[model samples]
Target: MTIRPIVRYPDPRLALPAQPVTVFDDALRDLARDLLETMHAAPGIGITASHIGVSLRVVVLDLDPIDGARTYVNPEIIWASPEMIVHQEGSVSMPGVSDEVRRHARVRISYHDVDGNSHPEESEGLRAVCHQHEIDQLNGLFWIQRLSRLKRERLIKRFEKISRG
Candidate 1:
């Protein structure tokens, strides 16, 4: 396992759609492991494959307190509760700032494991929100997109200033 470099914002790849994994090969498995390592090293709960310049529909999340990490390939949100909850969220790619946004309180996701076996699971609380956030990344969506127009503008400026430093 290795820590992969995170791609920062304003990178065109962040807006590019990710490709679906085709083969459950060794390389794919290694990428998932590396992603887990990278996420842990960042001390972040979630990471998307596009964040490392790999345009693949893969995401790794570690919301467990015991260092248990889960990798999802070709992840999709199968169901989301209508009830909404707002949480303060931030990203490693854009540090030192966070925003409050509303997201479904529960969700069910389906994805293939490293061995190519399909699985679906229900998640709630931070785990649910984190998974939804990462899945959004796979679809070229960022949390900032959920912000109001004014807030999004301010965040972009803040990130721009950070980038210039």
Candidate 2:
């Protein structure tokens, strides 16, 4: 298992949008596997390729082992419920900081598997939150951007402190 290095917050790459994946081959499979290992090493439940400085539209989520690991390529939220729910969210890039993020209670997502098969998925609860969060990261919208200005500033300060000592 290869655990790739994670790109930390404030890295310009984290703010850049990733390109869509066009090839479905051994490389793509390797990338997916490396992403899973990197996420496990980071100890995060969800992670995107951008988190590891790879500008590809890929995400891995392992909320529970029973569900196994899931990889989404070029994932997009095709539909979202009007109802909203708040959940604590953070990123592998910006570890040690988290805040309540309000998102759709349910979401319908369209994406491709690592093998290049297209599929639509419906998710709720924490799964829904993760789908939105990782998709946003793929779109270059970091999780903290969803926070209030005051909260974001405070959180950044806290992260800075953590990084320093």
Residue lDDT tens for model 1, 1-165? 889899877688888889999999999999999988887787688898898899999998887778588889999999999999998887767766679878999999999999999999899999889988888889998778899999889988987887778
Runs in model 2 deviating more than 4 A are none
Candidate 2 lDDT over 1-165, as tens digits, reads: 699999999999998999999999999999999999999999999999999999999999999779899999999999999999999999899889999999999999999999999999999999999999999999999999999999999999999999998
Candidate lDDT scores, in order, read: 0.88, 0.96
Model 2 alpha-carbon miss at residue 43, Å: 0.6
What is the lDDT, from 0 to 100, of the residue 87 in candidate 2? 100
Candidate 1: pairs in clash: none
lDDT of 2 at 126: 95
Query: Where is model 1 more than 4 Å wrong at Cα?
Result: none
lDDT score for candidate 2 against the true structure? 0.96
The top-ranked prediction according to lDDT is 2
- Candidate 1 C-alpha error for residue 132, in Å: 1.0
